[model samples]
Target: KHILRYVRGTTNMGLFFKRDGTRRIVGYSDSSHNIDIDDGRSTSGHIFYLGSSPITWASQKQPTVALSSCEAEFMAATEAAKQAIWLKELLKEIQSIEEKVILRIDNKSAIALTKNPVFHGRSKHILKKYHFIRECVENEQIEVEHVPGKEQKADILTKPLARIKFKK
Candidate 1:
């Protein structure tokens, strides 16, 4: 089976956390727009890292349908921003995190929406709850950065990928 082969080939693979690795929290968020036929909802996912090692991650179906891929990605980023704020607060208990957490998103439109208040005609339909990410960005809690789709590691969590792409 494919799973057995995968397990056999990665017996020695593991995440190594360095003692002196950067303490900053970085996150990658992604979504598969309108993937669920039953409800017409999208799937959202995010992965967080401390230095180079993954610290936390999530993948789940979105509660509502998104009219566009941009909207779906924006919602995903909003979820990640919430998690980032929590992580920042938890880390504050031990040490100070002076820099805003960087949340890498693959969609340029979503990043623009978070940074700019001006909304497009199509974007007007998106719910208000998803707009919280914009507040987070403005408050210095998180920064949304555009990452090319090919480099988005959170893609694996949003949907199934081909073997070649999954390896990336």
Candidate 2:
């Protein structure tokens, strides 16, 4: 099948884990507006790295339609935080490191939501499960930082853009 052929051709592509300390373990997450006209669901994407090389990445549709951009980004960060915790556990078992995992998201509103515990009317509609990111932050398992939208690489998987625009 064409899909199989494509997979075979891209077998060389993947995350490269390095023992060198030149890189830092960090993650990036992004999401698109609800653009699936039929379903109204947004896409979620995340990528992790050990320094400059990638260690894990994924792209998938959100389970439900996001009521706003902040919601979509929050979902993406939740997924990324889960992966970050898993990766940290894996690294501890196989190697020794004393650094906390860091996650980068472009949505300032989402970042604010995670930092603030006051569940007001705006955030009341978010599903309960997605609040796990806050717990993870409190436990020091993961830290979410704000990155500018133009610098978010996870944008590649969550939406379509022109070649020139994407490269930027």
Candidate 3:
């Protein structure tokens, strides 16, 4: 009963999309380190935008526990890359020529890890699947850049934000 009420109340809400003159999809990823006390797993979040409006987004608990904050962010980024590739392909249906997808992550270390293979020793313990982002970066299918935590829209999804931040 409550669910239906919430849905009905929000039915009038809609997304506003404007042409930003940029034919590209951009994404932001964030993760909260070990927020799930029971499993010691982090929550991963990502949001993709077409122009200034969000096209797709996700927030979920990581499948595995990440030993460090960097690892948690790294894993979160890998998931975001997967979503970016999928969204990029979907964009091809309407636009034949699309620019490379860019993903913004707040963690500089994870961004660097995605670009260089020299961190092999540090990353070897991570699940092999999480390494998919490295290939995506090397192939130039997606580009990862650093975005400060305050500007990360996905911050709301990874963890609970203070009332002030939430209002932003």
Per-candidate TM-score against the hidden true structure:
0.90, 0.86, 0.89
Question: Which ranges in model 2 have alpha carbons more than 4 Å from their true place?
Answer: 1-20, 165-168
What's the distance in Å from true for residue 86, model 1? 0.4
Predicted model with the maximum TM-score: 1
Error of 2 at 164 (Å): 3.2
lDDT of 3 by residue, 56-155 (tens): 9999999999998999999999999999998998889878746889999999989988998665777889988998999999999998999998899999
Worst 10 residues of 1 by lDDT: 12-21
Query: What does candidate 1 score on TM?
Result: 0.90
Question: Candidate 2: which pairs clash?
Answer: 23-51, 24-51
RMSD of each: 1.9, 3.0, 2.5
Model 3 alpha-carbon drift over 4 Å, by segment: 1-14
Runs off by more than 4 Å, candidate 1: 1-10
Ten contiguous residues with the weakest lDDT in model 3:
6-15
Give the Cα lDDT of each candidate.
0.91, 0.86, 0.91
Clashing pairs for model 1 are none
Q: What is the lDDT of residue 29 in candidate 3?
A: 97
